[model samples]
Target: MTAVDFEGFVERLATVAGEAVMPFFRTMIGVEDKGGLGKFDPVTAADRAGESAMRQLIKSTFPGHGIVGEEFGSENESAEYVWVLDPIDGTRGFITGLPTWGTLIGLLKGGVPVYGTMSQPFTKERFFGDGGSARCRGPHGERKLRTRACARLEDATLSSTSPRLFSGGDLVAFEALEDRTRHTRFGGDCYAYCMLAAGQIDLVVEVGLKPYDIVALIPVIEGAGGVITDWEGGPAAAGGRVIAAGDRRIHAAAMDLLRSAGA
Candidate 1:
């Protein structure tokens, strides 16, 4: 089936996921530490619940499709068509009662990202794309998504989930890029990427990411006429240290600084 055909189903998945997660927001929900000592990778019951709901829906609707999720492990991952999910992309923000978290749903065909959606139920907003085009629907009203042009780093606003995610040469590269930007903000997670797609942000640099963390964002950025790639200027579908720029000129400039730091 064509990617466009899955759009309706994707929204349904987002609805169910949001329903599963909203109950835990701003509540005293239990949390589990997925990371060991010296690290704080947090996961909540909300994360599992949301992913479980989506998984169940996918299994019932398209039994042959694969699923790769953050809370639940992969199933039939080598199938021709696969779904990548990060039910609560910003679990840290969720637990902290921040609305920056969202549910990310992505579809892959033949191992390539074809469609994606980022839904923030709290804000009643949804952003979606199909690599070629993108749009957003929210309380503010629906509009086509587009990245703003800012060709120079000095005129750009940058964002990252956190500086803690970087180290060694990666840290050096990110800092250099941050210094060149007009401003840098932290703690966006997937929301930062969405903002970049909406023409509100210019650059997003992140490291130590998994496929589930970035797969859904590829279409959103590309659809909005932005560039997303590894520090070496390669495909970002597989994750790892990645950089996204609203303007290709800024993208090329960021890559140069990253390369200089051996990132």
Candidate 2:
């Protein structure tokens, strides 16, 4: 696909996802638990339906592209282009009527994200990056995005989906970064990364994320002058342990803490 074609499609896909998610926003929707035995992870009709909508569009518009989604399994995962999806990224916020929840749409070229967007359907905001640049569109109008400059961890603001999402030594590792930061907040999921890319937050440290959860965020964060990588300074494509910083220096500082925590 040409560059323009793919970029335009990213926006189109976000719109499609937003349309799907709006139907179940605050209504009485059924939710099922998808966590380990008795753990209360949630999957709502919005999540399933949002993904189904995006998948149908992908299948019809780009029949050759692959799909890796949270609610559904992968399809043609080896294709040159794969659309990774997390229909409702922060299901907790979604079910609770919080606006931080968003639909994540990531386009991978040869297994690496070349484009991504986080669409908060309820708030009508879509933040996206097309490998080289990032921007946001919604009620506030469209504007270019750029990561803020923070050279030290001590001067940075930190965020994570939740402290509860991490456990054991991983929790300890995250706390090291947290304790060193200027301020700490929790629970934004994909939305937090969008904020970081838009020069709002500084660093985001998250662990145990799946490919669908993070793949779409990489391009958005990076294209906005930010850096996203695994704690050990590797490609974050596979998405197990992830750290994103608006500034490279802060990333390095946070990585030192994360790496030492694991040691």
Candidate 3:
């Protein structure tokens, strides 16, 4: 299979994401349940419309490519190259007027993420990674990005999507993490990984994610010089658990915590 143009694709996708999300930033709109884990967390018109826009852009610009989106199902799945889009990764945060939500776009070559971009329109911040390099773009032009050097879990800061979702082994692992980390915070979706990439947060442990949620994040986090994998150190493919850290030392420690708790 032939590889896609990572740089060009990121620019185009960023433009589409920015354009599609800005209008609905803080506007008054009704929210409805798409029924995943519950009713409080769901998609909105903005999510559907944004994914549609990205899919259209890909179809028109790269008709031979495939797509896997959160709102819509897969298309042209047999193509050599595929795009995974989560138009709005943080639906609850967006609906609640929190600026932590973001638009995620990822390109997988033969089912492996090779390039990706995450955009936060309200904050005017963008992070991108592909082919081993990652950078962030803001009002000051582009800046090189990297994870921090926090050497241990005890020394690191931690964040999770929510504590309520963890059950059985997941809940036990999370509790251990809380006891180990220097600090812990909550309420960030895919943006938590972005913060880790920027070195703002050191560790992000989460579960109940699809490929579209974590694939776009892999290159972004690792390219920024971090480590991301499932709790068992497997790749965070769709529908798998994820434990992303800004440094390898912390990653190993976090994994130890999960395994210790029988996760």
Candidate 4:
């Protein structure tokens, strides 16, 4: 009936996904190359299992709601309240035995992201937010999350999944961001956005993402007083090239650099 209720279900969904994925961690799991000959986009049994487990839970709890997932495709996509899932937001990291990967669970009401969560079960960490507030939970404890006040790009710490993930025009634009920021690091995926929400990283610029890749991150970032947008300064709900910043000034500056890169 309310978003709070939906948020609870999101938590359950994340838990289910975590359970399904943890079994495959560091187990020399089998990986299928989703990418082409020259690329390494990998998906494993854990990815498929995690998504399937979550889907079953969602269907049982909210049968009328639509579902959009990474592995299984979309179902009832026209329904008003849809659950967007990325069982393993960082499949590359998951396959590599890195704990940076997470299960992304998001709720979209009428096609706009209203709530989202990123769960790293291996680390026992989950970051979640509605449109207004964000929080993080882990083996240590739970605490409210808010983006740090960083007014300029030069003073910002930035991250991306990897420089290798970008190419052509997107690469040019991302390099422009890297050149402007204080420092840039690679390898984050969904964790980069959560780090921004925790006010650890100031900006996250990524390319070639699908809706499931970012829908869950949008609410958490926005709730923590950060901004998520495409390179053109548009809403990133549909996902593509994404730029998330902890401060408006920083977002503007990054967007400007992206525009110049396009020029």
Model 3 residue runs over 4 Å out of place are: 1-4, 36-39
Clashes of each: 0, 0, 1, 0
- The sequence of per-residue lDDT tens digits that candidate 4 reaches over residues 1-263 is 57677767777888888888898999989888988988878989998999999999988988999999999999999999998999998888887788889999988888999999999999999998987999999999999999999888889999998898888877888887788789998898899899999999999988888999999999999999899999888989898888999999999999998888966
What do the candidate models score in CA lDDT, each in turn?
Answer: 0.94, 0.89, 0.85, 0.90
Compute each candidate's TM-score over C-alphas.
0.98, 0.97, 0.94, 0.97
Off by over 4 Å in 2: none
Candidate ranking (lDDT, best to worst): 1, 4, 2, 3
lDDT per residue, candidate 1, 148-216, as tens digits? 999899999999999988888888888888888899999999999999999999999999999999999
Error of 2 at 71 (Å): 0.9
lDDT of 2: 0.89
2 or 4: which has the higher lDDT?
4
**Once superposed on the true structure, which residue ranges of model 1 sit more than 4 Å away at CA?**
none
The worst-scoring run of ten residues by lDDT in candidate 4 lies at 1-10
The local distance difference test score of model 4 is 0.90
